[model samples]
Target: MRLLNNLTVRVLIAITLGILTGYLFPETAAKLKPIGDLFINLIKMVIAPIIFLTIVLGISNMGDLKKVGRVGGKALLYFEIVTTGALAIGLLLANLIRPGDGVQTAAVKGGDISKYTEQGAGMDWTEFFLHIVPSNAIKAFAEGDILQVLVFSILFGVGLTRMGELGKPLILTFERLSKVFFNILSVVMILAPLGAFGGMAFTIGKYGLSTLLPLAKLMGTVYATMFLFVFVILNLILRYYKISLWAVLKFIKEELLIVLGTSSSESALPQIMEKLETLGCSRSVVGLVVPAGYSFNLDGTTIYLVMATVFLAQVFGVDLTLGQELTIIGILMVTSKGAAGVTGSGFIVLASTLTAIKVIPVEGLALLLGVDRFMSEARSITNIIGNTVATIFIANNEGEFDRAKYNRVLNQEAKNELADYKY
Candidate 1:
């Protein structure tokens, strides 16, 4: 019964059942997409409010404007360096593996790439920056615009901090309200199994497993590259700060599973923030870093964008010069940031990058239409892990992390696992 009640176990079971259902009853499983969509919608309803409150509380509680600036600066710098490396690594691996080589482009079906191309072409860096500051805060929340809410939250929190004693009652009220929303989140998470089930079912049913056969090589390369990026590159980053990568992974296993099942990292955003606090990251760091990381620190997405670009170049027999490859990296560094809060952003960003480079045919995107869903799980999982690591690293660097609390939490987790094992 305890095993049955375990969320991780239940989610695992749900994924298996979902896959089986999708494979066996493709039409019915495809219809189950709404179940997953509804669950995501339920999570989304709480997301804006939670982000607003958390950022407000974190900044107000910190009481140091300079520290906030320092934290944000450090996070942005870290995001740039790490994501650049991810882009380089993806390019390197794509060249080495040649996942797109010897592909019969004639045999593969291409989809309508016009809308994505249009979105990509229309994406403007200046407008993206301006969009961060919501003209109307309420509108930002209503639309679930994360970056807009983030900007508003920071400004509100700063104002609250400056107000000092005048803000005490409001702080208390905010704290209480935050607790209430989290309680609501706890209730909502009970439906995660259903969401995971439906998401997996729909993906398998609609795409079908056979869609993977032709693109299996590309899929394999992507998964392999991500695995190395996590265990090797990310592990080294943690080791530099004397943190245990394995322990951190163990701590957030549930969030990782949720991301894996849903193929959406945002699904686990709020829960991961709460868990990071429990694992000893300060509220201020978690607040400032996690949301921003979602936008700027997309290591997984960066890798995919580069790899896919190179893969297409190979498929179309377009030999990119060394200078052009560098340009691809530079352009992606900017376009990839546009992914924040955008649905189907991976393709949109890719389309924009291709348009900018003018070497790879944008039509090649159609070839990936079938398998992008399958690869999304890898991207989402890596992204969440990357963000969690960023929060922990930044917290420790700023002396905001509580080592005692971290050790205590890990010890308790170990004890619980041991007890469950003995059961």
Candidate 2:
């Protein structure tokens, strides 16, 4: 009973009940989507402000513009390297497992994939880069375009830093505002269980368990590959830093669970930022890397893009040559970054990649529409972990991490676990 009072426990219970409700009374479960939407909106309401304040404060406080550029450069390089590894691993596994083989093509349940295809077809790399610079900063925040806001914030921070002593007061004020928004996030988080319930209920009710039958192989392969990437690839990286991957996972288990429930990494963005700071990563590193990672360092989305593309090719009996597979990789490397941290962005990016490849039928996406929501949990969880690890790596390498604080937090957490066990 006492354990039931914990937020994690309560959220788990809510998810279980939600799935049951969706399975039993799908009509009613579908209605609960608004409850989840409200929770996400509440979280989104604070996101723009929090990001603005955090970025402004983080950059202005750093005192060295060169360090900022260096950090950004290192982050982008790391993101490319890591996500490329993810793409390769996904491609390799999909080829080996052949999850799409022997599947009847008639199993496709065509949905309106035209929107995604249109969005993909219109995707221009130049336009995407230009879109990062908002015409009006206010409109960027209003629209919640993270990349645009990031560009604006970086420029704003550089301008403020140029002001030298004159900027200190404004920086302090922004710091206070950042705290206020985080407090607002705390209040909003109280409704997380309800959000989880609604999100799970709606997904199950809308799609139903029957959708998993035909594509179970693909779904299972995706999850297994992600598991391999996390434990094998990501763990190797973490081990080099002398950090335990399992320990880090346990530390952020709550955030991971929240992502699982919502199927959106954005739902836990602010909280993850706060936790990373608490874990001793510098505020500036977290501010820049975390937001940027949402756009560029999408390890999970890259994996999915490559895997899904190959799976679709196999489903349609299109045999991609070695050169074609390499083309897929190159295309996805660029297109995958187009997928933001939103829930359905992956589908759009996938559509875009497929159209770019021009071999696989775009209609193959219909096969994934039903199980996409289910696969999102793996994607979201992997994304959060990847970004968090990236921040830690960058911070530690740049001497932005506080080793003493990290040890203290880890030790305290260990003590808390021991106490909980004893009781």
Candidate 3:
């Protein structure tokens, strides 16, 4: 009880236990993997509806389609710039570190790029754009079509906005459901430590250190470069701004621990929003930025994509000239947006990029596949922090931030309790 009350402390305990479990009882921990898989599935089960309802509620409250477009456009532009820079930096570091330099290993089997769309991965751009319409809302929900659900939710919300008073009951009902789901999220979070333990244990057990020995430098470079970017670039951005990353991150240290342990930032989504509110962001801003960014502004992961691509091509001794590398970045900028938010998304996107570049074999993705889970926590942790900071900074610039509320939030237990109490 005491540990749970101290969020950061509890999360640290979770991490320590997970690492201990993974290191000390590799076989036993590996068998316990279902706990993590089940936890992830439970979260995914709620995602489509949560995104639909939250987005609808958020948009309906906006009350103006024109405003929604403006906010969305600005938000997306921010995502693009930040994400591009991240990819470039990753490319740069991978080039500098040359982690796989002077190493020779037998090539692994490549991927079948055709598999992406067969398994609930989003369709191609044309088909995706066309299928925005839900043939049957019930079936769409049952199938868990996020884009379709997003489209339906947006249109429904716009209709509600246009309806004004008549839609109040429906909107209120959605609000209630949103709270219920969020409560479900909190209860689900209790399993975070178990998930972290099982997930970490299985990852390390399956791929021992020997798998990563040759590529450790590459991994180290990626992590080190991100550390510099966060401390340096992020400092410059936030020093002149309200709402320090350090403070907000400290507040949500528990969420970060879960993210670190499980390597799933999505698991931390609900708590992030709650903490954002407690950090005094307008509910609208938090509602708008976080969900969309989950799909869009994955800067840290973007870096890994470009880095891994170039690093692998280099290791393979295939030369991608400057023009080709730039072209690859441009292609990734667009495709990465289409990437899913689930586990192994980075690998999937890497597979797609490798196929497009026609340089490195899709098998190159297999190089980092084992360690991908390890890198995932770093990527996700930085991505969330960067996204949150960017959103707050943008809101501050737009005069959308509430400073007085922010100060009150840090000091006031009641408001923090309200944020904690999802239902």
Candidate 4:
């Protein structure tokens, strides 16, 4: 009974119940989607404001312009290097395993991929960069455009910094407002179990467990690759920094479970930011790196893009030469970055990558449509872990991380909680 009071234990039980309900009574479970949607909406409601406040506050407090530039540069560099490795690993594993081999393409159910294809077609790198500079900051917030909000926040913080004494009061006010939103978040998070339950129910009820049969190999391969990336690749990176990846994962197990049930990384974004800050990353570094990582550093999505593309090629019996495979990697490096940390954006990015390569038939995506939702948990989980590791690495590199605080939090010696909760 005492264990039931713990949020993590409750969420875990909710997930189990959701899975069983989804399997036993799929129709009723499908209707439960609203509960999940409401929880996610509540979380989303606070995201834009929290991000804006954190970035503005982080930058204003730093007081060093060059450090910001250096951090941004290092972050971008790290994103490219890490995601590139992800792409390469995905391609390598897909080739070695040949998950698509011997599958009959004609049997696969084709989804309405036209919408994704159209969205992908409109993705222009130049326009993506230009879109970051929100002409109307208010509109950006209203639309929940994270990158745009980030731009606005950075500029606002820089401008506030320039004002010196004039900025102090405003900074203090922003800090207070930030606290308010976090308090709101604490209340919102109490509904996480319901959100997890609804999300899992909708996924299983809509898709059903039987969908896994046809594409089980593909699903298995993707999951194995992600597990390898997290445990092997990410572990080595953390070990270099003298941190245990398993310990970090255990520390944030609740967030991972929520992401698993919800199948959307965005559902846990605000909490992740808060947790990372508690883990000794400077707010500024957490602010800049984690959000930007969402946009640019999608290690799992990148892996999925490569594997899915190759899987489609093998399914259709289109032999990809060494050069053509390299081309796929090149195209994925660009298109994969366009994949937001949302649920279905990965399929769109995969569609666009195939269109760019023009080697594999886009219709081959039909083979994956049924199981995409099932694979999404893996993608979102990997993405969240990647961003967390990036934040810790960049923070440590910039000397902005507090090792003592991290140890205290991880060792259960200190509790990072909000005491003044207001309704």
Q: Could you tell me which residue pairs clash in candidate 2?
A: none
Regions of candidate 2 where Cα sits further than 4 Å from its true position: 341-343
- Clashing residue pairs in candidate 4, if any? none
Candidate 1 lDDT over residue span 222-307, tens digit each: 99999999999999998988899999999988888878778888899999999999999999999999988998998889999999
RMSD of each: 0.9, 1.4, 4.3, 3.6
Q: Which prediction has more favorable TM-score, 1 or 2?
A: 1
**Candidate 1, residue 152: lDDT:** 90
Off by over 4 Å in 3: 107-125, 128-136, 143-147, 341-343, 412-423
lDDT against the true structure, per candidate, is 0.91, 0.88, 0.73, 0.88
> Among these predicted structures, which one has the highest lDDT?
1
C-alpha displacement of 415 in model 1, angstroms? 1.2
Candidate 4 structure quality by residue, lDDT tens digits, 258-305: 999898888999999999999899999998898899899989888888
Model 2: per-residue Cα lDDT over 271-298, one tens digit each = 8899999999999998899999989998
* TM-score for candidate 3: 0.87
- Can you rank all candidates by TM-score, best first? 1, 2, 4, 3
Candidate No. with top TM-score: 1
Q: Estimate each model's TM-score.
A: 0.99, 0.97, 0.87, 0.95
lDDT of 4 at 35: 87
Cα deviation of 341, candidate 2, in Å:
7.0
